[model samples]
Target: CFYLLFNSVLFSVLSDVELRSYRWLQTMIFTVEEINRNPVLLPNLTLGYLATDTCLSEGSTLSAALSIVTGQDKAVTEQCTKAPNVSLFPFFFCAPHLQVSYFASCACLSDRTRYPTFLRTVPSDAFQAQAMARLLRQMGWSWVGVIYGDDAYGKSGVQLLIQELEGSGVCVDYTEVIPKSHALEKIKRIVERIQSSKAQVVVTFAISPDIEVLLKEVVRQNATDRQWIATEAWSTSTHYSAWSGISLVGTLGFALRRVDIQGLGSYLTQLSPEEHTNEQLVQNVWEEVFGCKFGKEMYSGPHCTGLEKVEVQGEAYFDVMYNVYKAVYAIANAIQDIFFFLPTYIKYGQSKKLISGVKFTTPVGELVHFDNNGDPSASYDIINWHMGAEGKVEFVKVGQFDAARGPQQDFQLDLINMENRLYIIQVPVSVCSESCPPGTRKAVQKGKPVCCYDCIPCATGEISNANSRECTKCLERFWSNTDRTECIPMLVEFLSFQDIMGIILSVLSIAGATLTGTVLTAFFYHRDTPLVRGNNSELSFLLLLSLKLCFLCALAFIGRPAPWSCMLRHSLFGISFVVCLACVLSKTVVVLVAFRETLPGSNIMRYFGPAQQRAGIFVCTLVQVLICVLWLVLAPPLPTESAGGELGARVVLLCAVGSVIGFSLVLGYIGLLAAICFLLAFFARKLPDNFNEAKFITFSMLIFCAVWIAFVPAYVSSPGKYTVAVEVFAILASSYGLLLCIFAPKCYIILLKPEKNTKKSMMAK
Candidate 1:
């Protein structure tokens, strides 16, 4: 006879009797009877099982394991060919006997060195932890609370879960352990923590019993707002579902993949005390399931009718029986392999080696195999607890997690249900902070997890899209939009004709030029007049033409700067100003020399003739032309873009002075000529008569010097198109000064005061 030792939490010793555990016990017996009936697999072998009530006690479990290893139990006889112990309880003690577990999923049991004789049909908690972590990440539940039972199973599973959560952006807000003693005070404290935590998602890693105790405390406090994540240990257990109330609604969990056993329901329904009169466990189950006792029992319950039928209680209750069935079939397959393939008698320790290597398909077409760690392939059905049509809690299959597929493709949700499910429609938000929107980035709080953060707006020149962690800088020629969500082409800015300032400056430039033309017309109409001749008509005409050019040149600076306009504007202004100054200087010298000649026979009048005056003006103007020519050839100004102004949002299009030295020389030469003209004309101011040309020239030169002197600082300090505006203002001011001071009086005397334009009036003192 082959002996199968069945250990479970039975007889209601440490806790209340669990009907699901009773069903597991019956499932083991049913599988054993079925295997013995099969002739082709184990022809002459008959298998028998020894059931032990562990009462969920560690000492009882250890004692059962020791009895199997030492062969101390009277049930183990010398005729027994093999003894493979199948435990439905979590085994912490190691032994030599091949112990196969139906549901001991603790990851530490996978260590082959410590538990070499141990094999399990259920997957290890390591894979479950990974599956849980993946599910949390996929659901976007970054901030959550964790509550685990204070045992090797809970501690090991939580440790694995936390390890798997590293770098996954999932953070635990609080972790509390439920005491195994089921202390009310400790469980209350855990409930208090859950109530106080801001995390709306709480993960419970515990068995059904410990979870039941904790859930009662939670209900006592009425703390049911949280979305609970359940591990496989109690995710589908009916023990808690009975009393969990509406609190378990919207709870999501992972459960072992369920499979149906053929004829197992019929086998359970046919169970009766008459068939198993010697089996006390069968009587206890019948009494518990039917609420009746047998043979005048001590308890005050009704007697068994022997006609009560056993029916499947729930899907979860029946699903776990499949693991029990697989455990027995796995041992049977190993024994058959050892007898048929190896052709050797199975030794005491050799059974585990054969079982570890056995690979076969079940009658239900499911493959049964184990990895090197003696664990089956990890696969889970995602369950969502929601109110059913009957207004009771229902576990709805919503997704799946298969470890055979790669990590990227392992977890998947049923799209049809996920989209239409009532609980998922609102999709409970469990994060510590809401996701940052576009135009903002996440700023993690100090001394807090990454999930706890603040959303900060992007800087002026930077941008951040939705869910961005950091701000991105815009390109040099680009600028961020007002919302900082995207980069846009920068606004190109210059003194364009369309701008208000440009229009004003342009109007002023044209008005100045038109006024200069009117003045020129007046001078020409009075070309033979004494005032015109007295001021030297040829130099006066040249000065008027140069002033007109100066006024028009300001227009070049008013428009969008280009290569041609950039070089032309500066050169024209420089040359025009120099010519106007030269004409003034020549007139001043001629006036002073003529006055000296009148005092005594000075002979200076003959030396400072018309030809000499014209030659002097030509020479001075030529010098400025030569300087402008050299400036344009060596390092000419060019139109360029500058990033400046508020937030650098505008690209200022302006002409860049390629060579500072050349530009400075142009202004310096003009300043030098003005200064000389101003000094000479001041000296010649009081030499003669009514409207002294030298006095007018002196005032115009003073105005020119002051305008250019202020222009230097204003040009250097002004920004963007304003700099061009300042330059244009300076040109118009100086040109208007020269035109008004030098020519206004001449035009006044010529047009309005014709008597004062006489040669005799000009000669008067």
Candidate 2:
């Protein structure tokens, strides 16, 4: 005979609480009765039970223990053998000490040496605390506040949670112990510290009743913004069902894996006072469920009609209800195996060990089994409390945290609370500060964590796209694009013949060359005329040819730069302009000397003849040619790419002049020649010759000097291809000025107004 005592009450009770403990008792009873009726399975075995109520008191547990263990209710030496026990005080130790240590184990019944027959359906607090630790680390929450009850279970659970969260990059910011008796001031102070702390996350390991007290205090303080990590002890507890002030909306925690109990719904629906009147199990649940006495005078609400549906109360019997059903079937299966297969098994402990290998699947899909420690294998449903339609509470399945997988995976907190039209973000934020967006990096504030910081924009040529702890320097030879998130290659720019500005300059250069050709043609056609021959026709012809070459040289400065173009662009420009300048100097000298030797047939004018002027022009022009040859040999401009300059993501393709001093010398020598040409032409402007050319030469020298002077600042300020464009523009402007000012007036007289093509019209200035 299995004389079992089922306790209908718990260690404590609260208002509007779900009757989970009572449901566990009824499930065990239903399982025993169902097994006894199955003749084919256990034909000869019949199990019996004597049920009692602890009345939510330690004294009640002691009284129930004495009556079940010994026939004389006070005397307790030992039981006859191992029957069924409801003794919360397992007589193996002192009673009050056992109650104190219930939090450490299971009412201290887990000590196999002292109470080898004690067994429980509920997984102990040890495994739940370990699971809570794993959940915290998975969420990447390192700083947390812990609140615990002073009772045995809460005391031991807090210790275990701290031990588990220790080395996993998690630590407790504060630990508060709730007293066993309701100390209002102590609870209020503990909650104030929690609400005011910098940590946005907190973990609690307290009994259901203590949680209610702490939550009431929390609700009063309006501390609804923290992420609460809960354990199994109070995660599914219904003690806080009516407190609407505290939102508790996005709380994350572990919950027991639920399974559907087969036929339990049918059994609960079939309860009635008319049928099965002798069954005490039926009368006890029926009275409390409908809030009425079975035979009392007053009617509370609904009487035990027993035809009621089970769906109304079925939600309460999920997690712990399934565990109780599995425990009973395991004991039944072990008895069956002992009698039929292992006939020699007589010891109760050996038969209990056989329960380890029992496996079965209930009506629900979850498979039930046990590990060697008699605890269920670690698997928890990660849940979030979501506010649904019409402010209804819903426990949404956000993710899963399994011990079999890696420390952290399979969690998406962003999926919860999405359908609510009020909020676009899925979860309520539980961070000290919003994450820094892209293009900005985090600047850690003083005496604060990396999570709590100020956002600072990335510096020039640097980038940080996402939540960055610090701004990183851009890589060498690479620059941050317009957006700071990425680095790209710099743009290489150069002067080109095809671009808009380059095309206009190139067209001007060509037009200047054409004008010079027209002027030379007119001079050749008028070879015997006084206006053409009076100004030393040989030198005038040479100067006109040099100006044409200078105009054409401006065309070389356009288009994509390369090794060959870079080497010749500036060199050709310098040498051709110098030749034109040398020719101008020769004509200026010829004008002065011819006017000075006009008194008689003097040999002074012989020295300034056409042949002599030609020789001097050749000697002056050859000096520039020698300087260019040495410049090309020593430091020639070559094609090169320089990146990561003032402009970002653009590559500048300017031909890099190999030597700075050589480049300076080239420009400086050109300027020196123009200065000399201007001064000499200015002095000889008033020469007394009818066809004096020094006036036109003076104006052209003034224009040429002005262009190069402007080129210095424009060239230095511009970058990349534009820098080369400035120099090219200077060449075209000066060439065009010389062509327009000096040659245009003569060509107009030679072709358009042939009347003024005489020496009298030329020497009028």
- Candidate 1 per-residue lDDT, tens place, 1-765, comes to 677787765533233557777778778888889989898767898887766666556556667667766777632111112211222355222222466788788888889888776788888999989989988988889999999877777889999999999999899999999875677888888898998888989998887667777887787788888888898877777666666777677788888888878988877777778888886667777776777878786767688877887776554445568888888888887767766755443544454566578687888899999988889999888988866666666788899999899877889987468546545324577889899999999999999998889999999889998878899999989999899999998988888889999889889999999999999999899899888886788888988998999999998887778899999998988888888888878878887777766556557678788898888988988988888888899999999999766778999999998889888888898899999989988988887568888898889988998999999899999988889899899999999999999988888888899988897887676
- The most accurate candidate by TM-score is 1
Sliding window of 10 residues with minimal summed lDDT for model 2: 93-102
TM agreement with the true structure for every prediction: 0.89, 0.65
lDDT of each: 0.80, 0.64
Candidate 1, residue 102: lDDT: 80
- Please estimate how well model 2 matches the true structure, expressed as its whole-model Cα lDDT: 0.64
- Residue lDDT tens for model 2, 1-765: 443445444323342313555566667679778778878655776866544544434655567656756664332111122112233432111111111111123323445566443444455666667767766665556567888876666676787787777666566767888775667899889888997886778788765666767888887887877777776555554434335422666666667666666788676566566686875545655655555556655865556556554443423426555655665655655556656655344343355455455555544565666555444555566666655555544556565655556555533343423334222123333455666888898786797544566788888678886767666777765778677888775555556665788888888888888888888888899888766666667877887888898888877777777889888887898788888777777777766666666566567876776788778877876877777778789988887775524655566676777878777777777788788878888888887644446788889889889888888899888776778778878887887777776666666666777787676766686
Model 2 spans > 4 angstroms off: 1-9, 13-182, 186-205, 218-229, 242-252, 260-314, 317-376, 383-399, 406-448, 452-500, 589-616, 619-623, 626-635, 639-652, 682-699, 740-765
Best by lDDT: 1
